[model samples]
Target: MSDDDAERPLKRHKPQHEHQETNVTEIERSPDFWFDDGNIVLQAGPTQFRVAKSMLSRHSSVFRDMFSLPNPTSESTVEGCPVVVLAGDTNTDWKHLLAVMYPAICYDLTKPNIMTVISVLRLSKKYDLPAFRKESIRRLRGDLPSKLEDFRKLPVAGWLYLGEVSDVQLSRTIALAKELCLWSILPAAFYGLIESIFNHDGSYRPVGLSLADEISLLKGYARLTRLNTEAPNRAWLEAESPCVPCDDCLFRTLCRSRCASLRSTLQAQQAGPGAVFSGWDENWSDEFCGPCIKAAKEAYNDKQLEIWKQLPSFFGLPDWEELRKMDLDAGE
Candidate 1:
């Protein structure tokens, strides 16, 4: 990067390691409105609240209704109150993706104090708030795979996203689950994800394992792959078999069955003595069908007609059939 780019200032709502004063001044002084813990304060406006701790109360309701909020009573407020704040760097790419599914994460928390929701997520576990922790984990994990680029770019957010996933998104999730491990999983974890995805029709079918369970397996497998000294590419278990073995090997058989083009190459090799493996042409595209495209367009127009009818009605309009006839006449 140029020197000019390097000097750009980083901005964030929650200050970084530099701790600033946490004070709540009363716009209209009232004892009941003040929260004793210095971490949060109420801000009032000329005619309304510029901001308020009452915003946190909204987080409290969502915390409660997750259907598992720990304590329901107003007296339970202190323990249930959000106790930590987690913020990602301001320049995150996938914050767009995060915001797309924000409603699910923060429940019904309003716009003013989103950091409160993030803070609740980050510290819920540390403070023994099981319900909030679970909610946070669920939200983070749900968006984990799609936001991998974002996670990797923002190390702090990535670490938190990783910690959230390291236990639940194992090899199985890596393989059969959407391409979550597209970037990388340790080789064994790579194989495991392959096994999971390929073995079960490429859907990460849930087999009653908790998210935590899946992540634990991925972490364990990652550790194992790291310690092994062997090169992943050169380590082929199928190499011991004869070049043209008649032996019934399950691995070889499965590989051959799933890959039709490879089988065709094998047949070509057998037919020509002393032949080397010639790779099949990879340049074929699905043959386009003019009729199918036309049919699809018609179906799409029909669907659009339904959507247009549902919208506010025009006082007078030509029927669709009449519009088509007009087009035909115009062409003629």
Candidate 2:
């Protein structure tokens, strides 16, 4: 995507499935978050939750303000309680929010439920529920952590648990992060998407992302591929570096034999920025001379670290510190 592509029309939004139309006389009750003695009815889509207004007002300033507004003398009621049909929200979104907020059946955030995190995050933002929003962001950061060390611990498919998320959902995560101004997660999110493409065959299209984001990913992917191609394989893209000074008679051959032997493995192992080269074995050091061993361990890892540090810039994002600062300022 480019600035000039602003006029380029994208495919029309085609939903996989439409929301089931509920009959006016057949509104369904929520299995959870439905209090029998509740004084308010919150409906979204087809589902309705009877809940205590005091509790909602206590947690959400938006809700408090909305409730404090003067109601019409002829306001409609459901079961004698005021009905607040929240527009532009899905039943799932309301369900997740209420599940997390409800005292008796508080939803556990420890579970790896990205849907819960996302849904709660959206409603929490809209309702100004600071605590829930903060916790939801924490959960998102846990999955797409900023640190390279933490990032390496994730699986080969690059993000999400087995069968827990698909590439389409991951793409949606990118869109959500951008929309919410959660800039800190962008680097790792993009890296995860690209890494999945190379190593896991993940195929992401510009479904919900903007043209700028699409362009950013394309350029970043090209740059990452170049980096991966040159990564520590042939003396790390600096075969005759004056820094190493391995041209001496003793250091002659530059241990090229040992370094060359490992090129195929190194090339195959490296996917992009977070490439930890887990394929490397310490036992392989026996094949290297002293200087060559240092180069192998230190120089190679330094390159990957460099890539990790550049992750944000690769996607036209501010560096990690600036992005982190933005997130902090937003919270404030």
Candidate 3:
């Protein structure tokens, strides 16, 4: 027999007197839970939900195996339905999960808030619901790029968008990423965390961070500050151009103006290194002489890639390759 068959209970004849004694035990139905067609009652905390067993079993392998097992004779039974008490989960989380499972209700996955998505993700992972889990991951990764090149292209506004989501959500995302060894999402997630923690006057606040997390953010902030300050000091910026120009040449003046403008803008905005590089690309291109622009581009690209590689370390995480391998092993 297969593993499923091994778990199946052997059929046995029970005396009428014993069966009648079992039926005499009364199980109270929840006052608010009244789904006439539902086959099962799930109690989480004080809240009860009368939902279809097939609906849950269809989406979750864990639930399918659980429902397939025979219930103990002494367990609570309401009416003809089985009562499963989910002690570890909260009513709010169950409400959110069921909302997603049944679209006729209030939850809409298309435009889910950070907490809603997180709730779904947590429950889905617990229940072994692969599709729900994947969807939650995708929504959480929304508009955030994983690749170095793509991340470099994202503007300060994009980082702000991710950071502005809620301190609680940012904290949870960081914790979950650490737990799952999801390194690919860490760069953008940490960028959001840094933006949320550091204030405008250069002072830092603890916000939702623990002491260790605070230290990591401060260290990452210092590194980012150094990168932003040193970005314009590349050797090529001062290197002699092949196309010699006068002191008052428009190209020379424009190049200097653009560089200073970007540096000041980045400082004023308290932008991260990635945003600083993106600022250069967006605001400093094509205005300078061809040779000067080419050299500057090469320097910026090299520095940006270097910084990208060190991003995980800035947030006190293992390097990208190590994180990738860790996640891969976790899958097995």
Best by TM-score: 2
Model 3 error, position 69 (Å): 2.1
Which candidate do you rate higher for lDDT, 1 or 3?
3
Deviation in Å, model 1, residue 19 alpha carbon: 24
lDDT against the true structure, per candidate, is 0.30, 0.66, 0.62
- Residues 1-332, candidate 3: write the lDDT tens digits: 23442343222212224234233234234444457888887866666678888998999887798879886676555546666766466777777788778776564324566666667877776667888888777656553445577665555563312324766677777666665445567666767766666665566656676677767777888787677655543423433432222243457666666656544554556544434345355445545666666666666677677777887788788887776666523464
1-332, model 1: which lDDT tens digit per residue? 23442232111123322222223342232233333443232222211111223333444443233324442232212212322221221212123212322334556543322233344443332223455545543443333322223322433222333233332245333332222112212222333332333221223444444465455444433332332222111121123432221233334454333334433443343221101111112221121133322332333334333423321112122333343333211232
Lowest-scoring 10 consecutive residues by lDDT in candidate 1?
272-281
Which candidate tops lDDT? 2
List model 2 lDDT by residue over 1-332, tens digit each: 23332222111121222233234576798988778899887878778888998999998887787778776555556666666777667899888788767745356334546776788887777667889888788768867877777666766553443226655566677888866778888887777666555443324455455677778887887777666566544444254662243433245455665455555565566355434333345786676666666656666667666767887998999998888877732547
Residue 209 alpha-carbon offset, candidate 1, angstroms:
32
The TM-scores, one per candidate, come to 0.22, 0.74, 0.73
lDDT of 2 at 184: 88
